[model samples]
Target: MYTISTKLKVILVLVGALCFSVTVALAQGPGFDEDVEDVPVPFDGGVTFITALAAGYGIKKIREHKEKTK
Candidate 1:
């Protein structure tokens, strides 16, 4: 049978706990009201910056892996 390492087990538990906590917090928060009008979310530069950073990091890792294999 396959076995999981302690580090992986701890990581999984922490992730599960975080997801559970977030779910509880969101459930307790204020919900939509029919009387109140919906507001549009403004475009944020931070999201674009993060997306670009992630894409660049992925490209860099892929290039590194290709070089290593060669």
Candidate 2:
């Protein structure tokens, strides 16, 4: 079972990751979207990878924390 501090840390980490991703995305230069083509392919692989990376990092932290106390 996780202590309150552990839970809080996890939540804060997740929120920070979300904010970082949003800020980086907003800070990027404008892309070339000069076409109204039919069925536009939504390209969000970067976001997906970022999300996965964050999740993996979070899991690693949790596992390490658990191991450290044992």
lDDT of 1 by residue, 1-70 (tens): 1356877888999999999999989888577788998889977999999999999999999999999999
Global lDDT scores for all candidate models: 0.91, 0.93
Each model's Cα RMSD: 4.4, 11.1
Candidate No. with top lDDT? 2
lDDT of 1: 0.91
* Superposed Cα RMSD, model 1: 4.4
Off by over 4 Å in 1: 1-30
My TM-score estimates for the predictions, one after another, are 0.53, 0.44
Task: Check candidate 2 and list the clashing pairs.
Answer: none
**What stretches of model 2 exceed 4 Å from their correct place?**
33-70
